[model samples]
Target: MKIITYLFLISFFTLVSCQGNAQKKPKSEQFEIQKTDAEWKNQLTAQQYYVLIKEGTEKPFSSELNKIKNPGTFICAACKHPLFKTKRKFESGTGWPSFDKPIDGGVFYSADNKLGYKRNEVLCAKCGGHLGHVFNDGPPETTGKRYCLNGVAMNFIPTKK
Candidate 1:
């Protein structure tokens, strides 16, 4: 009887500790722009909705934004919140739009363990739209942080003369 009780206590503590590490997602209402699933689906194209709303990734090198070399700002497709500027963009050879940083308060991060390991998931601060992950592998001369993003999740607005 005592053995069984000890086992139960151990299990309970283990579960509680693990739950502490789980990420807590912010409620939709916390965002600057909130919308229902149907509303978001109606507003975004199929691909954009997939990456931005569903937290899905796009095929590497598939986005035309990857080839954009002009001066511009990348804004969230869901809310038009400014994210990355052309000056921060870099060629990471990873077939994604890589930036060393984002505009102030333009994005946020959450712990992502969907792959059975830990990763930092980036999201738009205004709309809570999933952008992509950030990594430490970036240009050393720069910020040394890679804000790898999905092109379908954003639209580039070229700077006007």
Candidate 2:
């Protein structure tokens, strides 16, 4: 009984230690596109600045991009860098734009624990702008990843004929 108790304590501590070392947000200088707060504010709208620069979230269903159904690409609103293609989009009914995956290497992930729990935060690879969170609760038929994104963080460029 004593040996079993000791093993349980060891396992508990290991789990706690791992969880304590949460991933930190990348520094602004690490991104390809660097901008000061003033510049970002000048370029993006109030909502855009809130979501992309200040790591804020917009009201669900508030973004026009959430209803976009045309073929094209979604680019970072802050930098116009390609982030996700329309083909990867799915009607997640989450009120925000949802995608199975992002354009390869166009975005990066960081660990976020602001809610008293852990969540994988997504950001633009080019500008280090906050986009949203990704989760495993996606369509299993595809990548099985639900990249729940803030629609205000991106702009859709419809494909031209």
Candidate 3:
């Protein structure tokens, strides 16, 4: 009986270890590409070109949509792809634009930021364009996420009447 119980325990642990390994994803699978400076320049706008391509951040509260409380869709400034919906917008008080969730699979996350602060870096899933970082400290009742984005990296499309 003692030997049988030890074998059962080992088998259970092995199954759990295999399950964990199966769920682990490779780093390459997280992001699609690493674009060159010229490639990004050719794809983004002057403002987007500066922020996303150059890794620059826009001034807080400078975005026209920062105070906009109307229904709208936020698209990638580089590709104009729909990324976030008005419903996900929230006042995160982080000074930059914030979103609780992204529109479906519009964005992809990867390990980012080299400031010694670990954060999830968000990017335009379609074109892999840089958007910003996402933090866990956000409004409750939702995903508890704060997608702090650069205003220059996005363009707001107000909902049509």
Q: Could you report the Cα RMSD, in angstroms, for every candidate shown?
A: 4.5, 4.9, 9.8
lDDT of each: 0.91, 0.89, 0.79
- Which ten residues in a row are the worst by lDDT in model 1? 19-28
lDDT per residue for candidate 3 within 105-136, as digits (tens), equals: 88988775355345688888876677888888
Error of 2 at 121 (Å): 0.6
**Estimated TM-score for each candidate:** 0.84, 0.83, 0.73
What are the clashing pairs of model 3? none
Candidate number with greatest TM-score: 1
Off by over 4 Å in 3: 1-36
lDDT of 2 by residue, 37-104 (tens): 89999999999999998899999988888878899999999999899999899989889999998998
- Candidate 2 global TM-score: 0.83
Among all candidates shown, the one with the greatest lDDT:
1
Query: How does model 3 fare in lDDT?
Result: 0.79
The true-versus-predicted C-alpha distance at residue 141 of model 3, in Å, is 1.5
Model 2 error, position 82 (Å) = 0.3
